[model samples]
Target: MATADTSETVAHNPPCTRRGSKDLPPDLRIVLLGSSVSENSGVGNFILGRAAFDSEAPPDVVERVGGRLKDRHVTIINSPQLLQTNISDHQITQTVRECVYLSDPGPHVIVLLLKHDQCSTEYQECVEKVLLSFSERVLQHAIVITTQEPTGTNDILQKIIQKCANRHFSLQRSSSPDDLLQMFDNIVQMNDRHHLDCEGLQNFSMTQQPTEIFSEGVKLNLVVCGSDGTLKSAISEQILQQTDRRSDMELHGRQISLVELPALTRLSEEEMMCQTLRCVSRCHPGVHVFLLIIPDAPLTVEDKAEVEKIHRIFSLSINKHILILIMQNSEHQTAELNKQTQSVIESFGGRHLFFGTKTQVSTLMENIEQMLEENGEGFFSTETFWEAHMKKLEEMLKKFHSLQTDIQSQGNLPKGQ
Candidate 1:
């Protein structure tokens, strides 16, 4: 079982590490919430001490990863910008709870990043709205992390801290890696002063019995989904047959998990689409690559439009974790596909695969491997952009059905009559 054992959850005990109180620190669990206030917080990269965030970009959900800091096991979770995004309050809490469980037992600290480039009323309201998700005592385990690192404490920085009730810290884009360690140390000390610990977290009730999503949180599930149901099912089956094998060649370097979601079709119900997305996001906290399997045949005009609509339903951040999977039903269609699909596939850059047999699937796995490698030592991950999907769904449904309204307004197509 690849489950995170009790030892992993217990901060003081680590598997394969020397056990003792020889200047060792307790395990630290941190949840990072990003806002327009802190676009440049760089928490993920800072924790890993290397670039971890996809394209080194800020995340939209709790992108959790394990790290060692001052000899203590550290689990850091990064979330999307709450203030800037239009996801409902309930959904924001859902993301927060996702972080809490990923941290399991409970998080040691909640770092709310604030970027004060232009302090406006909305930014202030953002802080208040975020606090609403947590209990009033949350401030005790919380710290206001300003994006701008302090060279010497100045009036500008001090005012922001005072505004946040003096529960604030500053970090700069150019700050050295050690500075992050110091910031974390401060959070731990502050929590200690308030007498907060894992026991306090239980009383807070943030980590309830978890919901059954994705069958117990596998390390990484490469979600192969797209418009063509038949091709997708075949691709997923092939990938898994090799995934569970003991042959190192089949599952080398990392233990990979495969999740086969139903097709992301044009005819999908709004509820179904939302649920599918939520399941993928909630179940897997590690990095993931999304394989959007487009058929090898030339897409009809309507099919092309449907693809565009699917792309629009999520925020642009999703592009980072996605690879366009170009699947041919048979080798015979290669020439026609090359003429048409090449143009569409090229846009995803080098992140794509020409899917088929073991050799072809191997190439796809290699591409995915490269993605995970770029993410440093962590698992392959996709940014979570599902929170605002309600609005995106509304926009898509309108665009899909309102085409007739626009056609009627024009009164007819030219020269067809």
Candidate 2:
């Protein structure tokens, strides 16, 4: 429930003082988390008002550099880039330990430096893992400093900022050191001028343990289909160990049966009908959720047609069980989606999730659970339901054909006869 300071002015004075204070410490310690060695070092230099960190140094270990910023003794703990795929557990542990040891008592604020191009799901997971490794309440004392201005459409970045209690600063927008320091001051005051103590650090060891992926006696039937075959297969692979069309597994204490259907738009009408029936039969009892995977790009004419085709085949009733999964990567960084995509999302009542890592499978499950609770615990689709749905479609098609025939007959007879 952290409220944001909506004022545009940069000259607002903080409620607390950090310099020469009687009760507060004289040193202002900060930790920097970034995607690369150069990024972390550069931010550290910017804060210390000098070239304090070696950007060219080996990126394996963490380093602490101290200097004086006006009347305040400032310390910067430059951590090696932890937001990468290949970073080992040992490296993460060693870096966290070094950061804690160097900062001594603890850091006043943790600054997360993100570039516009680095806001992918992988990076999101990495950031979450690193922060949780430090302390659960670490974000309470954290400040997200993006290198560029953040837009409202970047859901992942917005979520991180929200977790930090709306405490955010843009380095590109405000380049002045004083402005940055003022943000730090705001964090200190908000946290009651207290740093993350040993008790908080003790919470660090918990994230090191394996994540339990069970929910106890819950079973989920998921049907994944979309316009992109590659994305559909990839997401299906993440859920099921084998690459078969249908696979079953136990996750988050729920037995999950997943069925991946081919892109309907790519198939002939007969093939599409056959595949649709197969999809319904495989998940025989009923489908709990339908995941439609799409590439994270501006909606194209083909994309819109693909979505329309899905509705036509599954019938409009499929809308409630559908969740649009947008696969995001570094290549497609534009957050401003086109009108067509917006309209499509609105059609589904904005049921969507930005997908990136296997870690998010649990999140997807939770969302599916919530959707089930809201829409009732019944299955979304079954064999009999699909058969009746096809019958309705056939009846609608016959009516349309009869109306066309009647219109043509009337036009022929009334031609000035």
Candidate 3:
């Protein structure tokens, strides 16, 4: 329901008075990304100004909130370089390292600020690579926060989201401190839950034994792309749960990162490609499948063109794989509706795949397995890591298996039997 509904309200304003100070960790590392043109770029200047002029400004909000300041803990760094030229891989990597990596205190969260202009393809690709490198070290630790002041809905912002798989937030009409604080809290909570959930999946245990050899080279990296957070979150959570339940299955672990591609009120093909390339470069190399999460809604000519362009870009590489997942809402399924949706996606070179309305556990498992097979990875039959897990499970459940067999054979014999 949250659409870019207004056309005359996008205005860039100067920073307003902030409310209660942000209660950050005694000393926290904050990283902000933006261009020189953005109004909020003056954050550094504002901080410096407050430090120098406001001697009576109550003890720094961070200190008063029972936070600790370990040495080399509080650091704020911004990329000094621009993405205007030489978007080569080497240049992009080096710039990011210099700006983002060198900060003594690493960032807990990353905030991306954008206005309404389209980005060049070179810049987009460079940014994508930088993000990928960042993820290698801090996968679940990354959070993309998009901020937009009341101005016309930005096509560039929407493109960025589509490409980067980051989260989005808006600061439409007001610049109130309470709103800022609330947004900050949401970022912290979301990041905390995401990291914890990933850790859980990465550290799950099993109760079985195995004797066969499995493929060690195959890595199934699945990237699910969509605009709706509800559908995205639901699909990702279900995939994780299903993978955890199947001990015998060669589950190629899932890494669910959301890309909120910016969709401006106006359309610009050049800007869209640039942003998409940037985000794609950050993805895992083993990401054999790209799931385009499309909601069943009427598509505009511009929307259709955007899809066509993205498809062409993705298809450039024979190694890159892509799929279309058209998620129909809670409405009754009809033949005509299905036909219309399928045609729309197929026009863009994507196959229309459906995951049942409830997206049941069975459906999740089957869909993943099918994807793995199409991408040339064999069934859940061959994973050495999983074999080891099976071994462990077999050991733990060995006694129970014998007991159950005896009871079944003797028609419910007593435990002593």
Candidate 4:
């Protein structure tokens, strides 16, 4: 059996040959969809031949882990617990996006895990909802894996299996890793080696298209602000240079403009205010997204102060439009995040990504699009900027008055002498 390799290291390793001569793709991507985290993670671990995913990971967050299995590089995307009755549609949509994002092009197999004896209408409905969340044709690429022997009397389970063209497997009956690998291969072969079409996965239907956020005339204005000035400049330059820029300097077809903002701490108070106003003006009506580039290192006092200044200038609500871009050093990438870095991310609504040196432009754009979608296609408008400015003025005025009152009270107090 092939042992699991660390996901971080898996990408850099060479692909191995598979057991058969079926001419399978080098990568086998599988997505685990189930109600039980333990069952899902267990199956994931079983397939990868190691415990790569955390069974205790938040039920709302989808995770992906990759490893080399025999001759093929296998990637498993563990979806959030979507079968619960209380799961919201938004949560479902978010999970679908994350799954698609993690799976990249798409998963080759959708493995639905379930207990053999557990059958209920609600459970079936939830399963259907999840399956349809990807696409109606997703069933063609699906397989049902039951914990125990699937009995003939379980109508719900039978119907699900039938819907999936009877592609079923018993985890208990499958004794070796090869059995599971073969199952995945069968699905790949049945589908003619084509992965699930992800172009439509963004909208949950083959016919539906993603909203035209970057419609012909509208340009996406991005402001790259962060404590790490060098990283910010590098990211901004990379984005501008790599994208297809037109004669007018805007990106062709989908227009995108990137502006780099230096650390506030480096600027004098007057320069800081002027720079903020200048950025807002250059972005015009609004800034679509603020890619706050933080180096993949512990936050220094200057970094914290810069972040605080950003919050003060943009208001706490600015977090809705902020996306943390952690510039990771390829040689120093670690599994664990810095505590202060994590806290900074949490403060910004947990919107972050570890941007390695080799990260692509598409990945950054996708994150920006996801953040925009979450914010209801809204941006930090000029009105919002002024509102935050006024709020800051109000706070300063209150503080000034309080200080004046304290001074008066001290003068009125009995002589300290």
Off by over 4 Å in 4: 1-22, 149-152, 203-417
Candidate order by lDDT, decreasing, is 4, 2, 1, 3
Cα lDDT tens digits, model 4, 75-111, are 9988747666666554465467567766878889998
Ranked by TM-score, the better of candidates 1 and 4 is: 4
Once fitted onto the true fold, the runs of candidate 3 whose alpha carbons sit more than 4 angstroms away are 1-30, 33-105, 108-214, 227-230, 241-275, 300-305, 316-320, 335-340, 348-350, 377-417
lDDT, candidate 3, equals 0.42
lDDT of 2 by residue, 1-417 (tens): 001121122222334454434444578888887767776776777777777767775454456678877767888877756666556554454366557766878888888877666677877888888888788789878878765544556878777777887777665543467767877877777777898764454233211111133234444667777776557666765554322222234322335556566566656576577667656765646777889887777776667777887887877678778898877775555555566667787787788877765335657767776787777766766654567677897999999999999989888895577
Candidate-wise lDDT, in order? 0.53, 0.67, 0.42, 0.72
CA RMSD per model (angstroms): 21.4, 22.3, 23.5, 19.1
TM-score for each of the candidates: 0.41, 0.44, 0.39, 0.50
- Predicted structure 1: lDDT: 0.53
RMSD of 2: 22.3
Error of 1 at 398 (Å): 47
Instruction: Please tell me which predicted candidate would have the highest lDDT against the true structure.
Output: 4
